[model samples]
Target: MVTGGTGVSGETAETGAGGGEALATLHRVFGYDAFRGEQEAIIEHVVAGGDALVLMPTGGGKSLCYQIPALVRPGTGVVVSPLIALMQDQVDALRALGVRAGFINSTLDFDERRTVEAEFLAGELDLLYLAPERLRVEATLDLLSRGKISLFAIDEAHCVSQWGHDFRPDYLALSLLGERWPDVPRIALTATATRATHEEITHRLNLPDARHFVASFDRPNIQYRIVPKADPRKQLLAFLRDEHAGDAGIVYCLSRNSVERTAEFLNTNGVRAVPYHAGLDGSVRADHQSRFLREEGLVVVATIAFGMGIDKPDVRFVAHLDLPKSIEGYYQETGRAGRDGLPSTAWMAYGLNDVVQQRKLIQSGEGDEAFRRRAGAHLDSMLALCETVRCRRGQLLAYFGQEPPAEGCGNCDTCLSTPETWDGTVAAQKVLSTVVRLQRERGQKFGAVQIVDILLGKRTAKVIQFDHDQLSVFGIGADLTEADWRGVIRQLLAQSLLAVEGEYGTLVLTEASGTVLRREREVPLRKEPKRPTASRSGSSGSGSGRGGKSKAPAVELPAHLVPAFEALRAWRAEQAKEQGVPAYVIFHDATLREIVTQSPATVRDLGTISGVGEKKLATYGEGVLAALHARTPPSGPAPEESPESPENPESPQSPESDWPEPPDEPGPEDWD
Candidate 1:
């Protein structure tokens, strides 16, 4: 247990080499001043030749826990990552910081692979990233054997758990790393994990002695809201236009077709969006991913295949068009937003169909009975989170084994506008009684639509065809609207009082249904909010405070400084294009905001601001100073429009070419 590291200060004992060097490296390379959470301790331990397991939230500076130790230690650090598509960008980001980083992945040609390998052996690289699959090859293992390894950093460590949301079979072989190199220290890190998943990772990776560090799983900057789904595409559009206009985000769908449709709808309605699924050509996916990273305000409509290791720090929102399978998957997906610690949103459109479809999928899935049971348990937890009347954030944290605030987190939809829960016992009985009549009298089972229609006293064709008007339960629920009836059925499904069976998602009664009908169980259900009307006030039924327009700072910028900030962004965009890197790679928006506010006149002065590390200070400092000078506000009234503002025709947001059309059919990877 290496210790002696203080807060953000660089002061430390010589014995704990990482305490001082880690802080120095952070400032010199990444441009941050202090260590966040357990970063200092984790780095110090790894630097002193000890193993560690780190579980921190996204955007919690997980990279530095290993990167700093790698730089401070004697030999190059080898990183085992699961994202082959993102390895290059990861390496590029590191290189932008003036760190010698390389990756050996399928994207590299033979010559390129040999070159990286030579660099590794010659001690010319500080960090080398490899896909977990790469380590399976004999040549790759032989190459590592000849090199002096500083440490092994296993990223996305939750993948080792077979039951984890994003499990990878290749990760199972990672356990061999400890056996092959017993003397070398290792660090395994993941952004999302429950206690069970954490234990599985430890046991799978043979990290019995590794020190465990579990940071709080709460992301206060992200406001979580699950609205009842109406027209999900339109709901998503309203969300984007009202609260997150012109902001970059991700929209997750459960099907490839939905991804395509949503992207097209957003494009036609004036939101720039692109589709990404495994069915698309690999190059197309790569191109789309690159554009998203480089362009501002671009939204990627995708399935789960995207956004595993995305490092974009400025994503303002992550919207789900469908229900995710588990709480772990939901947390991991939503955590992608607000990586920069700026206020962001985790919004979802949940409805009866989502519940029915998810249940159907679980039953029809390829897994055995045990796998289905595990999957069912996962879905149950996610449903509980969606139907929760308490703080959404609190429910999420509790699922991860963290004790949330007793009163509730005030930022989520429930906390912001407390939902009213009514005595739904009667409503539950009504729905259960209707199901019983259908099955017992008619010897028929139908989906939510048929059940809802029958209860609402609607003389639809199916009801009349069955001569169901004679049924005693018919029209008994006429007091409730169709939407209300559907809501009741959805809640019943969530509570396990009702069950979905067969391919068509027919509603059936579970064993618990008997208690509801017997009046022995009291069903309390959240009263669904009325359908939201369109509003431009930046407020809607989802909740208040939509984080405002894109490119806007967390705190409003002074009118006088807005032009300078816009100019800096334009300059940064040009630099990113010229260098083929993300704009944040050059300098984060937070760093640029500070530069504009401070109006640093010289390169040396710019270094004083956070995120202006030594390498960036030397490479882009003069250019940044020049941009600030060019956009100096005139003594008279400010110009009508800055270059990046919406009013400007030449603004990046105005170009349709920035968002390309996705292929008609995406690949058949994993469908909901």
Candidate 2:
């Protein structure tokens, strides 16, 4: 089982000794001079054969926690991933770093699987990736038994938790791993998990003794905004044009039809977009995913089925056309944007219909009473997040059990343009009175529209047919606009004072409605603005109105360096095309930007740049130098060495080096 071979290229034979060696490996292999928060601690612990349960935010350099340990340890590290579709990209990225990584998934042909299996078994792989379902196969277990695994990494560990937003049944079988390989340390990692879900993952993964590391959940780079829905397609188009023109983004919809329609609408309106959903043909879905990953500035309008393990780093925004069922789901989806630590937006177009639709789905969903209750609780939390008048970031972090600063996170919509809260007790009474009159007096149930129409004294045919205009509550709500009445109803539902029932989504009063009707409880609601606020750039020059910090300005190449950046990008694109890999697999945009800014003349100078490890330096250094030279003027001073360039032209730090360190304690904001 321990037979040895030279192993794949970039294989490190030295066993993990201590932090010194780990740092060396980081610099030599990953080309990073420093580790981010808790990265050093996690790596050291895992390398020392300690189990860990890491709750890092997305883009928190989680892969490095297990990867460095794997490289430093003697044998190969076996990673169990749930994203079969993204396994190739994962492996490709590692391979680009000159690491001996391979993946065995359904995407591979028989011969390809066999080759990877042989490499893993022969101790020729530094890392072996397997989809969780692959473990269900006895042959996979047998093969793993024939290999020397230094450690076991369970990626996306939250999938094992049944309460998790994105649960995968196959992850339940992963607990068997600890029993089978008693000596190998195991680390489970996820980008999002609440305390309950965290406990579930620990219990389900059989890692009760594992060291738990819960990083702060704030994604400061992402400016969260929940806008009022009004012709969502047009609003989305306007947002794209106004703030994120030609930027790559994701638009998540609740249904496949919405995904397709949104994609079509974006395309028709001049934004290049593609549709992705489970309903599409397998090949079509794969093709669309591939295109989204490879092509720049192409938006993918998708259902929840997409974006689980997508590693594309330049996504500028994550817009939601429909409400996500829970904060965890919303966080996970929105976390997809700004993975590069640049300013991005988490924009959602929410309206009363979204609340009604979500409630109706829950009521009609196939679940037991307990399940429905849990789903309802989840919806309540999401609705609360949407409705909160305080800092959005604080509420979001609080949901995950982390304390945020007393002041607002000025980056969110609420912090940027705070909405006023008004006493809506009379408005609440009128709406509840209407529902009560319909149910008790007329023995009728009507959806929000009809109720609103009746309350506003509109003699629409349906209202007139039902003689609803004669009701006492009729015309009482005429003081408020139709939009204003809908906001009240939506908030009432959110507060559980109102309940949604039946396929038609008729609104009904809950037991608590009595308190509001009798004036025993006060109702405060966010007042609907006369005009919806136009979507703003999360990275714009405008500061938060409440004095909360805005996100850092977006990273832009200087005009003088733009040519060099573009040329390098063109070269990277061609290389990616020829190699049949995503462009980032060759060199990240950050690295290329640095290359343009520094204008490294020799391969040695290029080697000083972060992300330019030994293998990459050897493979692409000459090409990079050529690209820079081509863009440089022949007669004048080198632009990079010119006075306008950076003063300290020394080797640049990793792109993330400038990123603010996450607060040492639990309360401050952190970038994902």
Candidate 3:
């Protein structure tokens, strides 16, 4: 059926779009009030038979991007997913939404797989999820050839990037989608991808001229921070105690051993935590993840593999036990937090070895030498980002080709606590001079530690044996610590002023270094390390995302509703548990806060809060209102309320002790 209507908001509603009226159908069938962002438009274009490559964030409601169109269109939507858990999750979620969905994978025995495949071929299922490996098979391809696939979606599409941190060889074979289903509109979606990775995805997925939907990388709900990695366990404990003392979160580490040790340390410190990595037994890994998702106030120490397909939106914090290799990876990992759109924290405690470890990992990988060199160079750039003396958020966004607005975010460590820097143009020159001298005398001899030792004139067996170490500049910079020199090298590398030269991949300076040597550029470098190094390469937090508190005092609503609000929260958590969904999916804290404030006695009153959709109010209003009436007496009078102050100021405001102090002046915080 053709649909006709002017656009809802000043935008044009182009006609002849694919799955015309899919949005209207979705509203009627799925009970959704409206589409979020470009969802409706993307669905319309797909109905119009155009391709799409969506770069939506994880919690941005991606499933509806294709689901609605699939249901309204003539045939099934083929969603290619890599994991069995993801397939089952989506299929179940769709079915619960009143849409028939099915998946065919190795987990199902032959009979069940055949039954599902047959159902898909018969158009009984509106959506079909398949693995890329399965899709590559002749039988699956033959089955797909007979069906009319309205649209094809490649989830986790960033896996196509060989340059990306998460690369799947099976994903490379998916490029054949163009050859197989040329007529069907295709959409590839991933929560993470930079310009380089994006290009790779486009090329490999053969999604040329596909519309690109890039959401703002800034997750305002997430408080971004990086603490100095000193006595990491203690710092983590302090952070947890101060902020997220009891909340659900993920702690990421770089290695399997670190994952185990950090999880153990955190558990001993009274944080219920589990370790996850590729090294763990399959069943154990699944159990750890299940516990993390189902249980509240649990933390999981893991590598990159754990949280990719997860939907735990209410995570109060996302902490990295080790520095990530790139800002894109870092951003994506942190995006896991505050997905329920409440305030959350993204923190990292990192030091110098994180840089060396990532560099070594890149260098040791089996790939083209030139490629490894590029990877190592990219890793150094990321290290500079982590240790940056400027606004971390600004530097991060700049790397992704988006300039953060000029105003400071006031959330990151740099913005909150500015660091001092010195003009190291001379130091840069000296370092370059040493590297050139070393290259002239011998080939790429050793790693950074060795080179620094030589420059500082540390008398060693190798230096004494190579008596020609009578170099003029040797020992001249002995006053500076090795860490200080390493910082200089990292900065120069980040600025593209240095290069790791030769097939052996030794660090050297590029032509840009000559300008610094000639004093054409003055580099303002850090005088000393501001952040401390964790004794171990990785450390898990005792509790939460301790990015520090905002100077703004906690907003005061009313104390009379404590029992009611707590009851409501408890019920919401239970509902989420029963449904096997994230608690935020049921009700966000913000909405609940409004519920307590508004004390909506009826469904009509619940509609006043901003995020309360008609369906949500219809489904949850009665229960929430019942919780509010749990029959508990009100407690003491509530503390006075104040407007939220800027978070960048001195420190977060603590609530008052006495009920009524001088109106203008806040009294001191009572130690009691």
Candidate 4:
């Protein structure tokens, strides 16, 4: 089984002999001046043959933990990844950096697999990526046994936990890595995991004594904003038109049908978009994912099945049209944005229907009582986050048992909008009184909209059929609009004073409702404003993520330096196209912005930029300098007219004429 070959590239012969050598590789290969937060410590520990459980954020340079150690240690690194896309991306990125890396997955033909296996066994590869399921095969184990492995890296280690949002049953067998390769140090990494999920990962992976490095779960570059759902399609279009026109983003919906509809809707409205879900054919899903990754300024409307280890670094936004199952899921999904360390938006629109559907999923799911209870608790915590009136970052970090900084994160919707809360005691009494009248007096159970109608005295066919106008509480709430009453109901749901029961999503009074009915407890709810609050944080200074102002964020670049930035981006886009890669692979927008600001004239000055590593500098350094030197003064943005110019086809039309009114309110059937 042992096959031999020479180094694929001359750079493969380079090795980090510890101390200064590791630092040399850090700059020369990975293109960084120094290791980020606990990276150096982790690399040192793993190189010295110690186990680690690293909990770093999405763009936190987690690969360096195992990669540096792999290069420093004596043999090839074995990485277990869950998704084939993830493996391909990492291997491609590694190969681009001049590291000898290969992957074995179903996408490869038998001969391709055999070739990679041969190279790995020949000690020609510094790192080999495999799916955890591959480790279950005896032949793969035998192959690993034949080659000396520098370390065992378990990517997305949280997948080992049954309670994790993205759990993979195949990961259960990964514990054998420690049992079989006892001498090899192992490192597990994940972007989002709670204290329980963390412990579950460590225990399930059998790394009981591994050194744990829990990086701060904060992603300061992503601005989190959750808005109340009105007309979801309109809300989304407005968000795109106002803030993220011509930017790439992921729009997560709850169902495949919605994904298709949303993508089609976006396309019809001048924005390019694609739909992705598990229901699509294999080729279709792959094609959509490929376009989403390879093309710029395209939105991908998909289900939760889309993003896991997707390496596109310039995703400008992550919009959720439905509520995620839990906070961990939300964190991971939103974390996909701003991976390039530039400002991005995490925007969502949630409503009572999202609450009902989530609860229904948990209740009818295949699980025991304890499992259901835990799932309910997780949903409750997620609901708490949605309704949080304080700093979202504080609540989010606190869920993971980390304290927020004292000043509070000024970037979230709550901090930026400063929503005002008003006493809802009387409102709660009115709503609770109506529920009591409907069930106890009239022997009728109704959902939120019907209840709103009865209270508003709309006297619809159902109200008249039930003769609900005869009741004492009927028409008492006529002063408030239907929207106002819905807000009251949502707040009550958040307060646990009201519960929706049965498969019908009927409004029901909880024990807490009795206290509110009797005036024993005071209820306060957020006053739903008629207009959306404009966002004030992040780099863009236009309207709020929910959309208000018409003008785009003013571009702040000085007129003279704009040409340099454009030239660099033009060159980067050309390189990316030539290599069939995403443009950020050459250099991110943030790096280019920094380059423009500094106006680096030489390869040495370019090397000093944050993202310009040694290999990248050597490869593109002169080309970048040439692009900068070619920049001419006073051209006004671009020569062929800005894509955002008045004549641009991608520009938004009249907002009112372009979008349909908010779709009719969700009916009871919609909840199912």
Number of the top-ranking candidate, with lDDT as the measure: 1
What would the C-alpha RMSD of candidate 4 be, to one decimal place? Answer: 7.5
- For TM-score, candidate 1 versus 4, the one ahead is 1
lDDT string for model 1 (356-412, tens) is: 888988898777999999999999999999999998888998898899879998889
Q: Please provide, for model 4 over 157-229, each residue's C-alpha lDDT reduced to its tens digit, 9 standing for 90 to 100.
A: 9888887668899999988989998999999999889888889998999999899999878877678888778
What TM-score should be assigned to candidate 2?
Answer: 0.89
**Model 3 TM:** 0.77
Task: Rank the candidate models, highest lDDT first.
Answer: 1, 2, 4, 3
- Displacement of the residue 617 alpha carbon in candidate 1, Å: 0.4
| Local distance difference test, each candidate | 0.82, 0.80, 0.66, 0.76
lDDT of 1: 0.82
Looking at model 3, residue 153 earns an lDDT score of 84
TM-score of 4: 0.89
Report lDDT (Cα) of residue 299, candidate 3.
Answer: 90
* Model 1 per-residue lDDT at 534: 69
On residues 29-148, what C-alpha lDDT tens digit does candidate 2 reach at each position?
777666666778898899999999999888677788888899999999999988887888788888877899999888889999889988987889999998899899999999999889
Task: Tell me the deviation in Å of residue 450 in model 2.
Answer: 1.2
**Model 1 stretches with alpha carbons more than 4 Å out:** 1-18, 547-555, 633-672
